[model samples]
Each structure stands twice: as structure tokens, then as C-alpha cells.
Target chain A: MNLGVDLTFLEFLASLPALVEWNDFTVGLVAFAVKFAILVGGLLQLPPLLVWIERRVPALMQRRRGPNRVGFFKWRLYGLMQSLADTIKLIFKEEVVPDGAHKVFYHLAPVFCVFPAFLVACAIPYGPDLLVFGHKIPLSVVRLDVGFLFILAISSLAVYGVSLAGWASNNKYSLMGSLRASAQMISYEIPLGMSLIPIVLIYGTLDLGKIVEAQTSLIHWGVFAAPFSFMIFLICMFAETNRAPFDLAEAEGELVAGFHTEYNSAKFAAFFLGEYVSMFVLSCLAATVFFGGWQVPFVPYETIVALAGSPNIAALAGIMMLLLKASFFMWVYIWVRWTLPRFRYDQLMSLGWKFMLPIGLANVVGTAVVLAVLRFK
Target chain B: MNPYIPVIIVLIFGVLLGSILSGLAAFLGPKKYLKEKMDPYECGVPKVTSGSEKMSVKFYLTAILFILFDIETVFLYLWARTFDQLGWLGVVEVAMFVLVLVVGYIYVLKRGALEWD
Candidate 1:
């Protein structure tokens, strides 16, 4: 018996540019595919790594060994492989659909939870535009004119997942958890939006890439220009992600597993992945907006080009720098998560409305006043 | 090459990934349906009432407040983006808009709409 495999598809993929009309648009499509792969692939890979980091950091903080058993024979690397093991276990575990549950919605909630996380990543520029085959291509998957607003609007839809999951479970705790989660998200979202108003005021653009490009020098970063708004935005980021000390939705002491009480196996894993993805996206946004995204502090573009000997190398270095900053913020998330206790529901609500709202409002007015003064001068 | 193409692609990817994972679990995992196991959890005791019962009105109040403030913030974003072009007039307009919201906010606080207890 002779078996022959067809290699035509592989050949066709290699010959795509030649087979199709080689124009700017077609070349752009190819470039976009590569950029999309890099962005999505990079983001998808992060959740597992974040899971590992989250576990290890808390263990180190608490003086207990985290997951020291999963790696290859005797070289555990402090349980770095635990996330992998957990993924496998979750995938193989039993998935239960509670009797009398809303069948369609029960399945739909996890999808809703996970989708927005990926969608938000599309707008974030991972690095400066790269020159590919003499053509300039943006590092972001999508560079919308209103990149910031797109991110905010899409990320807000994430609340639907928790609310729907809680309601569909037909469980009291889940319902309460969803209610708290939705309420907290909506409440904090005001400050989140308001805090960014000052950044837009200073940057004068809603496009995140343009905002980053404006911060060519270290002093031009939004953090230094508007420290108050940065502080408020950082606080809101924590609350928006359902992280400590604002993670009342999943406060195990009171609400069991909260909105995810009924989820099992992969569905449960989906929510877990979504949370980590959201954390990463928020960190990236913070780095891009408040900090100089992909900008090596004090290093000019010409300096980077001279040091790297090529623009592509410089762009890669910029990408690494951006990732470094974003990762630091992600580490902060874990650090805060392990250190702080969850807030009481009453305290949480009051903090969002009474304290944060007023401060955010005042910050906006202050920013406006300062900007107006500068313009007149 | 539309700017939104990547967003649509990412969205489709997310939906597919989510569906595949959930479907895989449903297909691969063991099926054991027990009446006790399927019931909505309430510690170890029987649930007092259905989970779908009416919740507190405070949630509604919070939602209303959110819509009001969130819309104001959106307006702020628009004004902020174009603040330079609009100059002092824009700042004054936004200030007036915010003053109106502050009044509403104070009224919300006085009514105890935000108080959980």
C-alpha cells in the first residue's frame, strides 16, 4: 500500500502573494493576519502564565510552597507546570448542568465572559508600527480612531456574563453575587471613565496609539502630567476587574463561589481565564495610557534606531518594554490580591459613590482648569 | 483591511474558543444526574424560596445612578477630546454640565438612595 499526502495547500499558502494581486490592500491583509496572530496568540498565552504567577506569589508571600510537584522528574521549577496540570484537570473534569437551570443561558454566560477579553486586546498597540517588506504596518490588530472608547464600551459588556450566569443558575447566592458584581462594575465604571477624561484632555486624542506616541519623553507621560487622574484610574481598574480589595462578588466567605457557583469543569475554567485576561488587558491599558506604552523612558526613537541598528529591532525592543511595564502592573494585581482583604459591600458602594465619584469629578474640573489656563497662555 | 476587521476576527475567535471548551467538557465529562445534586445550593439545608424572587430596590437605584453618571462621563470624554479646539467655552460648558450632575448626585445622597441599610 502506498500513501501520498497532498502538499498543494501548503504550496498555495506560500504562493498567496503571487497568486493574489500584490497591492497595498492585499499586502495589508497579509500584514494584518500576522499582527492579529501575534496579538491574540500573545494574549491567549498569558492567562496560564498569570495563573502560575498568581499562585506562586501568594505562596511566597504566605511562606508556603505553591505547586512544587508538577514539573519533570526532580526539576520542578517551583510548580511552574501547575497551571498546565490544572488546565488538563479542568478540561477532563465533569461538567454539570443543574436541573431547572436556564439551559441556553447557562451555556451562554461563559462565552460572554470570555469574548470581550479578546475583543479588548485587539485595539491595544503592542508596539510601534513595524516596517515589513518596505511597508509600514501598525503593531495593533485594529487601530480605530476611537480606540479608548472602543475598549471601554466592549469591556463593559463583560458584566453581562456574571449577571447572566447568576440569574441562569437559579441559585440565590449566585443571583446576589451577580447583583453585587454588576452594581460594583457599574458604580466604579463612572470613575473609570471620568478619570480618563483628564488623560484625553491632556493628550487631546482618543486613539491610544496616538496617546502613547505623544509621550516621547519621560516627562510627557500621563502619570506625571495628571497624577491625580492616574491614581483614580488605577483604583478603578482594580474594582473594574473584580480584584481585591474590591472582589466582593467572589468573596468565598459569604457567597460560595459567587456568580460562578454552578459552573463546572471547562465552563468554570472559562470564567477563570476571562478574569485573568481582563486583568492583563487592564494592565496593558494602564501601561499604555498612564505610563509610556512601549516607550523606553528617556530614550528617543533615533536613539533606539541607532542602538538596535534597525527599525525592526527597535520596534521589537519597544514591544518588550511595553510588555515589561504591563507585566509589572499585572504583578501589582497579584501583590494587592494577596495582601488586601475584601471590602464589605456597604463600604465598597460608599467608596465608589461617595469618595471616588467626587474625587473623580473634582479631578476633571481641575484638569480642565489647568488645560484652559495653559491654552490661554 | 477595515479597522474593525481585527476586532470582528478576535470576537469570532473568542466565541469559537469558548464554545469549543464548553462543548468539549460537556461531551467528554461523565454524566451523573442525581436530584439532590441538581438542586440549587443553600448550605446543607433546603432552600427557603426560589432564587428568582424579587431582589431589593437598592439594586435598581444603583443602576439608575450608574446610567446617569456614566452618560455624563461619556459626555466628558467627548468634550475632553475636543477641549483644545473649543477653548474656554468648552470648559465652561462642561463645568455647567457637571454642576447639574453634582446637584443630582447630592439629591441622590440625601434621599438615602445609596445607603444599603
Candidate 2:
């Protein structure tokens, strides 16, 4: 209610050095380092595991054995180690630079592909704030007030990598694939962003952390409050990520491996890793936005604290809860990828512009009208 | 520790990781570049035409449309963030704004800007 005195998380962080003692600075630094390590490590480690899941889940669905031959000794662990073996092989394999390729952009494309994925991850809040030595430290790396917009802006940069890869490759298929990728991402981004607006309208804030806190219970979750928006967001998310049903960018039937067709070795692996990491980040965003992030449904923070009798345990539980929700969405990614067939290029474009865009606009208008009527009462 | 400081650290870390991985492969990987291997892959057959030709105008149309609609979304975000304080007036204003965009969208569709052959 005190609009004049309200300070954003960035402002609060800026004021820390002035208020804290010398010893407290050391503590803060140490805590920051530890949090950074955990966040970065978990993000980097997840894609390989996802690669394993992507393989094994589809295999089970199709009644085929997938990658059951890469593990130490006799216990193969259902070929979970296949990702590791693939990484090793990629690291040592020979890279091919196609003749007549634009050498600079070709090499730079993979770096551009991978960087934005990790950059977006930096804004995602994985757990509730932790109380350390009477200091409340947020579990996210950054807490920008405009965090949601920041995410959209950073992610938009990812198209450059694909587009550049296509242009720089000097290969026809790669060019087509990249063009499809840019077009798909650009088209879907409208509905993806439009669907998110109603939630922002309802919550009246763009900070993802505050959005999660607002949805403290299942009933308060954005999914229930704006179900249509949730559906639109989920559909658009698939298209944005270029996953199944919307993965025309890499349609194997025509494009032959898509944008990365000419890429090889670790350069190729960068694009591969970037795709999975982007998937992970998008799933996490879904969890944070629609689901009650870090909050157990039907269970409040007080109940969590009461049950655990310690803030640390409760925070850990919150992290696990968020991860569980995010991982489920990730599984849905794989499930949908295998279950549905890829959309034709025209069908994909029409769906974005005709269906999703109109529905998303209508949802925003509907939410606004409903809110206004409720307020006038 | 500024909140954004961690974000900077993460960005630097990402760049480093990408460069290191790519650099390691380039240094360690075998290099026996054959002329045939360096050529663009076309199902292992000989090339028909050069790859770097001017693309379709449809891609350019999509890019222009993306910029137009994306700007509208930015306004929507700003309006949503301040909706509660701005009250019903804000709702009516944004409604009209969206309505105008919807008309443009309809025009685009009718004009077949989104069509692909």
C-alpha cells in the first residue's frame, strides 16, 4: 500500500553493501557463490538426463529397446550412461567445415545458440527464499521486477543462432531449416506472450517470484484463474520450443536434420544441448507461471515449516516440489513428441496466426471485462 | 552482492563454457579434410545448384509481421502491469487497442500474408 516507499529486489540488493558489516559481506559473498554454483550446475546437468529420458521414453512407447548398451559392468541402468558416451564421442570426433562456408558466422552460431539458454535460466527461481544467519536470501540468481519481459527479450535472441547457422552453413537444407525455425519462433511468440498477459493482469506484477508467492495455494494458481490462457500458453510453448506437432523446423522427412545439418563435433553438440536446455527452461517457466512454483498444492508454507520444524528442510522441500513439477512438464514434452505427428509447414503457420493469436486476444479481453465487472460490484 | 551480479556471472560462465567446449573439439579432433567431405551434404549425391540463393518473400513478410505484433504485446505487458491502479479506464483503452490490432490481423489473414505455397 505504501507506493512511495516500495523498493524493488534490485534496489534492496543494491542497498546491501551499505547496510551490512564487513563480516556480513563475506557471508553474503560466500552464499552468493554457493547459490550460483548450485543453479548453474543443476541447469547444465539436466539436459543430458533429458536426452536419456527423450530416448528411453519414446523407445518404451514404440516397444523398442533404446540405448541399452552403455554403462559400467553388467548393470546398464537402462542405458542412462548413453548420454555420457555420446558426449565423449562428440568431444573427440572430427569437425567438418563445409567448403565455401562463411567461417566466422558458422563458428559463432553454436555459441550464440547455447548462451541464451543459460542466460534465461539465470532469472528462473528454483526455490523459496532461505533464511541464513537471519538474512533472507532469495533462491534465484536475479530478481528483476520486469523478470518476465526480460525472459521474453533474452529468448528472442536465440533465433539469431538458428538463422545464422542456416545462412552461414552454405547448405540448402540448413537454410530452409533455419528460415522455418525463425518463422515458427517469431509467429508463436505472439500467442506465447499474449497468453502470459492475462496472468500479469490478474497478478498485476511481472516479477516471477512475486507471481509464485501470490499463488500460495492450488486455488490461487494461474492455471485455475485463467484456464484458457494456460492452454494457449502450453500450446504456444510447444511451438516456441519447436517440439513435436510444431517441429517443422527440423522435419526429418524433408529438411534432413534441420538447421544443424552441416554442424559437427562439439559445435553440433552445442546446438543439440541448447535445444534441450531451452526445453528445460521453458518447462520451468511453465511451472513457475501456471503451477504453484515451489509451493506444494494444498499445503501452505506454515504447514511445511511446522512439519519440518526447520526452514532449511522446508526450503529443500520447496526446491524438490518445483523440480518435480518442472520434470513432469519435461516428460510431457517427450510424451507429446512421440505421441503426435509433426504439423505441415502451412498448418503450423495457420495454427499460430489464425487459432492461437485470436484466442489469446479474446482471452485477454475476457479477463479484463471480468475483472472490471468484479471491481464495480 | 547486487542481484544482477549473479546474472553477469552466469552470462560469463555460459560464454566460457561454450567457447571452451568448441575450442577443445577443434584442437583435439582429427583433421583430415577431404574435398568430397567438405562439400554440402545432399543424401551423399553430387550437388545440383548453389545453396546461397535469395529466399522466398514469405519469410520477410513473417519477420515484418512479427515486429508489428511484438510491439503490440509490449504495450499489453505494460498495461497489464499497471491495470489495477489504472482501473476500468485502462481496460477500455486496452480493449480498443487490441480491437484495432485484431482488425489488422484480419486484414493480414484476408490478404494471405500468412499463406505458404
Candidate 3:
């Protein structure tokens, strides 16, 4: 367990002049362009898939057939391409702008909503160091010093879009919906960030990649060591993503269609896409922070790569493993969204402020005391 | 890789591209200025007296409090990093710092600063 900082980033650059030189900037630029393309395409497709997921999952729970009639190849695949077909159908449809709507704000809200999710995706490590023109480039788009804080801040900004959308809509339901969303997000954010303090305390760094590296052993995963923080994080993550039991903002019975009530066509679709993408981002953040992120569980990295795979291949496998975990959690978002009813506003507030906040603070103090005692022992 | 170079380029490009594309969209999109269409209103409601006159200040107050206390944790983080170098004295210093902050928090609590009206 030799844990001292071995090499500063600058020292690594100095040692490997060829590998980390000016020429590598070209590789980084190309990788950035590729990642941007992937992000845009993924955003375009994300909403339709999520719509399909919402329908199919709820139907399965309630014993009904869902979207089995839309695609050309019908019953065999149960209209798997329904989402693709639906998206294409949407593009040609007329975008409706209401008579008194603030045109500029109406147009700008979708862009604001979509971009945060796109920005956060760039921080997630996808594959290993992918080679291009004989230069190895890290799969992540950019590594920022304040990666976690950037995510939290950027995510919080989406509420402004929702709030503005409601204010602009001139509808009672939409206003109520947006106001509910704003209050809910602001409240849960405290517990979410508080719970993360234990992880940052344990790892001693906010860099996502470094945190992932520290969880090399099974026991080091924050969930096992700080179970209370893990539970609080999970609960708050669900609320942050606006999943069921916490989704009072969009409760259809009360607020008809919620914040995007007055929006039609592409603007309507943007809000939906923003939601699922944010869901994936939250799941990925949890997986990376608390789980043993791309590190292979129970197997030493050197031996696994040596015995059955190359270093590059093993790294790719690990990245895929992390993505798989994230995807499973994303599905769970759909599952919970269908399974539970929306909470009352007072119930939601009490749950976050009363139960979650105190529990999270206690967890941080508990972890600190345990660590300090173990150091003395 | 030479990380600073990439980060600089991204910052520059993001700013330049964002402004250019937004400008282009404004120029290219149709401009139809009608009294009924251009007026600031929503769902037939006039914009002159829209939105709640008074929102809960409690929400804003809590947010401010959260950010203040959260930022204070940064000092504890620094102390944790240098705990060995500072020894028991450093630990005592941090404890006192936390104690003072907690007292300030308690004062705010007793004053009902966090209470929702």
C-alpha cells in the first residue's frame, strides 16, 4: 500500500517528452472533435429511446402492451425501432410558438437545458487511451481540476431553464411545476454535496480519474466503508434526477405536463432529452465515486492484463464495465419512475431537509472519527 | 499530454463558436414582429404583472448558508493534507476552527434564521 504521490503531472510530461509533447495537442484536438460529434448524435437519439423506455417499462409493470405497432418489422422486435421512427416523424412537424410567448427566451431555454448534460458527458471516461495516427489519447474529452463542482454547478443551472419555461408559458400548471422543480432541486442539492464530502475526505482528491484509481481494492470502494453516505447519495441522486417518489414537479394529475406544458415540437423534446441524459450523468457520477469505477474487482490489474489481455485491452474492458454499471442504473431509473407514485411537496421537503441532511452529516463525522481512531491503533 | 494547451484551445473555441452560432441563428431565423405575437405574455396572461410577487426567502437563505458552510470545508481539506506536518497542534487548530464555525451556526439557528415562515 505505497500511497505517496509518485510523479507530478509536470514531472511525467518532462520524463516522456515524445508522449506528452506539443504534437500530442493535435491528438487531443482530434479526440475532442470526435467526442463532440458522438455527444451531439447521442443527444439527438436519447429522448426517443427514453420515451420508449418509459412506455415499455410502465406497461410491463401494469401488464399492458407498449409501442408494439410502430416499426416496419412489427411483433418480432416489439417495435424496438419505434423511438427512431418517432424521432424522424417529429423533425418535420411544425414548431408551435404561442401568441404571447417571449420568443427569444422560448428559443434559448432548450439550448440551455441540453448543453449541461453534453458538457458533463465529456468528463466521463469511455474507453482506454485510444490511438490515432500513432499517438495515444485519453478517452475522456477534458480533465478539469474542479470536475465534480463543475458538474454540480452546471446541473443546477438547468433549473433556470425550467423556471423560465414556466414563467414564459403563461399557464398556472406550468408555473406551479417549474416552481416545484426549483425548490426540490435546491433542497436536495445540499444533502447530495454533503454526502460526497466523505468520499472526497477518503480519497483526498476531487479528480474523478484519481478517485477511480484509489478504489483499486474491493474494500476501498466508498460504499462499503461509508455505507450511510452511500445511501444518502443514492437517495439524493434519485431526487436530483427527478425520478419517481420525488417527481412531484411533473406529477401529471396536478400539473398537466408540468414545466414543458406550453412547449411543442423540438422545444418539448429538448426537455425530455435533458432529463434522461442527466439521469445517465448522475448514475455515472455515483458509479465512479462510490463503486470501484473502472478498476476490476477482486483481480489485480497487472496479473489480469498479463495473463489474458494486453494493457490497452484491459483498460478498455474496465471502461466498458463502468459503462455497463451506469447503464444498469439508468434502467433502474426507468424502473423506479414507473414503480412509485410522486411524493407530496411537504413530504419531499421533510425527507430531504429532516432525514437526509442530518444523516449525511452524521455519516461524515462517523467516517472521520473511525479513520482517526484507526490511524492511532 | 500537454494539458494546458488543450484546455486553452477548448476555452477559446467554445466562446468563439457559441457566439458565432447564436448570432447566425438570430440572423437566419424569420423575424415577424406583430403586436399580438411580439408582446410579452403567456397563455393569454399579460406579462406586466406575472410571477409571484414574493417568493420564499427561506429557500434563498438556505442555499446561501449551504454554500458558505460548504466552502469552509475547503480549509479542513487543506489541514487534512498537511496533518502530519502540523502534528497535534495542527489538529487542535482545526478543531478550534470547526468549533467556532459550529458556534456561529448555532447562533444563526437560535435566531431562527433557518426557520421557514
Candidate 4:
């Protein structure tokens, strides 16, 4: 079939696959591929583990045995394999594409959920630079200039997943649930955005790495610098991520599994994975921005290097520190999930819009006023 | 050394991963289609109506409010980035700017635009 025009363009397109060289750019691309794989692979492992935690923690709270029977042939790895077993079962379960559902978007929705979680993972500073084979590689994937905003931009796209899931399912419960979920996410986003302003104002940079460096001391941390900002951020983080106390989107009592009611098999699993990854993503952000990204409190960065005996080891320490801090927030996520009851739709909206938004705005203004006065004086 | 190369790669990776997982499930999972099974869940009752209807206006209102506040934040981000250089003059100007917006915010509140019921 002879198509119209541009034979040479097609030739270039065909030859594009053959383009390869061991240049710096290609080397960098290879490095990025490895890093991306490691980061995403690691995150892929997290959901099932988090699923385990989510189950076990709630069971512990409720004083029940929560999957303690999923042992390996009398070994009983203490119910650790339960999520894995559930995952395998889910993968093999009957795939159900409900009648009248939008085929394209029904499948596409979970992609929207998982993509942002992985993309924003690139921006988070895992640690200081590591002397990887003496090349001084930074322990992050992408080094975009608009770091934090890039995170907000991408992570906010997660709403598209839940909203799309609800719409495409062609179910009453799903549609209403999606409507509520999308609105709830958007409502909390105002305070989420407002809270970030104080961090940017205090640090005067969009780069997470720079912010981490600036918070060298405990008192200098963002939580102390803008306590209200941190509070607002923490509140919105729970609401926006759709965790309990704010998980009106998937309120099982009212919505019947809410957005994912129609999903089954791997598509359902994808939503589960996406939710856990997003929780981890937001927890990492809270730790990085407010609690000091990778800083070891009371000990200087140079002191850490000296104590650890190498820059590489020190970088590992930083990574550990970041994970430690982020995991604390993750614990809070689970704790809050089990502790607080779901917010009423009206209560959730009013909290995000009326209560949190105004306070977040005031916090930003207060932070600016104080910073201006202190610097000028 | 395009930063976007990695981002683009990750995006493509995401698409491929999602499609692959869904396809695997489609291939691996058991298939038995019945009319009742295919129908949307309605608590074990026969289907009475289609799934969609008119939604609350408050959702759109919240969205409009979000757009306004989100734009304000973009400007706030720019100001925050150059906050130190802007000094007292910047503070006063931004304060006045926010004050003007606060009247609108108050109007939004008093008019009960944020009310859920």
C-alpha cells in the first residue's frame, strides 16, 4: 500500500531503532534505566508488603489473628506470605469485564493511578551523592529544576484513575463514588498546595535536595520553621490520599467498595498497588519536606560522613534516615486508618475547604510576614 | 542528557507494565460469562435502572474553587521562590494582594458557597 508523502521521514523512523553509541548520553540513559528499574522494582515490591502491614496492623488493633495461618508448610513466616498468597489468587481469579463498561478507559484507569506514583518517585532525593565508581552520582533518578511542583503536578493526576474507574464501570455506586472521590481529592488539594508555599518560602527553592541540605539542624527543620504548614500538610495528605478518616471515596458502608467495585482480577490488584504506592509517595514527601528529607538530627552532614567512614556509607545512612522518617509517617497512615472513623461527605468537604484551607492560607501569610521581619531586622 | 528522556521512559514503562499485567490477567484468569454475572452489582437485586444520573452541583463548585485557589498557589510559588530578594516591599504588596482576595474569600464564606448541604 503506497501511502502519501515523506518516504525519507519513514526511513529515519525505521532507522531510529538502530541508533546506538557508548557516548555520555547513552551511558546516562543506561544509568537511568538501571536506577528507574531499581526504584520502580523496589516500589513494586512495596504494595504487597504494605498490604501485609495494613492487614496485620488492623488485626493487631482489633485483637484478632489476621492471616497468621498463611504459613509455608508448617514454617509459618508469621503471616508474611498472606499478601503474596492473596496476590497470586487475585492474578489467577476470573477476570471480569462487566457488560456496558468502557473497555478502553476501564483498563486505562489503573495506568493513571500507578504512573504518577512511579514518576514522582524520580524526584524524591533518596540521599546525598554517592561515589558510585568514583563518578559522584546523585542518589536520585531525575533532577528536574521544578522538583516539588513536578511532584504535585504528577501525583495530582492520581485522581484521574479513581474518577475514571468510577465513570467507566457504568455502575451507580461507582459513578457517585468517583464524583465524591474526585471532589474530595480536589478539596484537600487547596490546603496541600497552600502548605507547600511555606516550605518553598522558608527554603526559597523548589529542589528537594536543597531543602534537605537547608534543614541541617533539628530546630531548622521545616516542622519547626512552619509548624502550622506541617500540620496542614499532614491533614491534607491523609485526605488527599483517601486514607481513612477521609476515605469517603471507598467508604464500604455507603459505596460498596466505591470506585473499584466493578474491577476484578489484576485490574483490582493494580488499584490496590496504586493506592499503597501513593500512600508511600505522600509519606515520603511529608518526611522529606517537613521532617528533614535525609538529615540526621543533631549530627552534621560532614560529621555523618566522618562517622560512617566514607561518603558512600554516609549516603547509605541518609537513605536509611529518609526511609526511617518516611516509615514513621507510613505507620501514622496505618494508625490513623484504624483509629479514626471515616469522615462524613459534608464533614470532609467542610474540613478541607472551610477549616484547612483558611488555616493553610494564614500559615503561609504568617510565615512570609515573620520571615520578612526577621530578615529585615 | 535530556531529563525528560528518563521521564518519558518511565511513562512508556508504566503503559507497558499496565497493559502487560492486564493482558496477563486476561490470559491467565478463568472465564465464564453469564448475564447475571456480567450485570453491574446492585445488592443481588434485578437491574432496575442504568448506572448514571445527574450529580450534585457542589462538585462543580468545588472544582471551580479549586481552579481559582490552584492558580493563586502557582503565583504564590513564584513569590515564595524569590521571597528573600522581595523583602519588606514584597511582603506588603503580597499582603495587599491577599487582602483583596480575602474579601472574595469572605464573600464565598458568607454566601455559603462552601456549605455542603
Model 3: lDDT of residue B24 = 38
Q: lDDT score of model 2?
A: 0.88
Judged by lDDT relative to the true structure, which candidate is superior, 1 or 4?
1
Model 3, residue pairs in steric clash? none
Please state every model's RMSD to the true fold in angstroms.
Answer: 2.2, 8.0, 9.1, 6.8
Candidate 2, number of clashes: 0
| Model 1 Cα lDDT, one tens digit per residue, A1-377 | 22485557777588766778767788788887887787667766787888888888888899988878898788988788888888888988888788868999999999989889888988898888888777888888888999999999999999999899999999999999999999999999999998898999998999999999999998999899999988988899999989999999989999998999988899998998889889989999999998999999889877999988888888998899988999999989999998888889999999999999999999999989988998865
After superposing candidate 2, which stretches have Cα over 4 Å from the reference? A1-26
Best by TM-score: 1
Tell me the lDDT of model 3 at A161.
75
lDDT per residue (tens digit) for residues B41-62 in model 4: 8789877888877788888888
**Per-residue lDDT over B1-117 for candidate 2, one digit per residue giving the tens place of the 0 to 100 score:** 566776787788888887776666888899997999999988998988888878999999999999999999999999999888889889889988988988898899899998887
Interface RMSD of each: 1.2, 1.4, 5.0, 1.3
Displacement of residue A146 (Cα, Å) in model 1 is 0.3
lDDT scores of the candidates, listed in order: 0.88, 0.88, 0.69, 0.86
Name model 4 segments beyond 4 Å from true: A1-27
Sort order, DockQ high to low: 1, 2, 4, 3
For model 4, how does the per-residue alpha-carbon lDDT over A138-219 read when each residue is reduced to its tens digit?
7789877788889998989999998999999999999999999999998888789999998999888998889998999999
Which CAPRI quality tier does the interface of model 1 achieve?
Answer: medium
Local accuracy of candidate 3 as per-residue lDDT tens digits, B1-117: 555454455445443433332333244445555666543334466556544345567667766775676566555555555554565565557657766766886677687765543
lDDT of 2 by residue, A1-377 (tens): 46787898799899986776757557667777787778768867777788898888889999999988888888989898999989889989998999979999998898888888888987888888888878777787776788999899988888999999999999999999999999999999999999999899889899999999999988999999999999998998898888898888899999998999999898888887788889988989999999988999899988999998888788899899988999899988999999998888888898888898889889989998998898754
Question: Candidate 3 overall Cα lDDT vs. reference?
Answer: 0.69
Specify the CAPRI tier of model 3.
Answer: incorrect
